[model samples]
Target: VVVVVVIVVIVVVVGVVVVIVVVLGSNGGNVVVVVVVVVIEVVLVIVVVILLQVVL
Candidate 1:
């Protein structure tokens, strides 16, 4: 459980950094894309947590 949580945290951190870089590189032009990406990421994380709970 601890290992899974640590991995998830690391992935989320990397994803956030990538998203930030993308948004800044686009100069705010892709605001909609960014929102969609964020929503997708959140959903994926939720799904993973749910699966983990079920399995554990």
Candidate 2:
């Protein structure tokens, strides 16, 4: 149980960090694309957590 929680936390933290870095590092060209990317990342994180819960 502890290990599962730790893995989930790590995954979430890493996903958030990646999103932040990408958003901050990108040049200003398409705001819509940025928003879409952020939304996709968030959805991916949620899916990962849900899958983890189901597996554990």
Candidate 3:
């Protein structure tokens, strides 16, 4: 379970980084989009963590 959580977090982080890079490259860095992506990523991670805790 821990390993899975770690992997999920890593994947999420990598995905967010890639998305931010792509967005910046294409749109010349839109702060609103970046912020929204980050917020969503954070919420996803938090929800995953909470679910894991509840399951365990």
The best candidate in terms of TM-score: 1
From the highest TM-score down, the ranking of the candidates is 1, 3, 2
User: Scored by CA lDDT, what does every candidate get?
Assistant: 0.79, 0.70, 0.78
For model 1, residues 1-56, the per-residue Cα lDDT tens digits are 77777877887787788788887788656777678778877977997789798988
Pitting candidate 2 against candidate 3, the one with the higher TM-score is 3
lDDT of 3 by residue, 1-56 (tens): 77778887897888688776877687755766777777878887898879888988
The list of candidate 3 runs beyond 4 A from truth reads 1-14, 23-29
What tens digits encode model 2's per-residue C-alpha lDDT throughout 1-56?
56756776676677667667777877675455657766876776687778778887
C-alpha root-mean-square deviation, candidate 1 = 2.6
TM-score of 1: 0.61
lDDT of 1: 0.79
Better of 1 and 2 by TM-score: 1
- Write out the backbone clash pairs for model 1: none
Model 3 has an lDDT value of 0.78
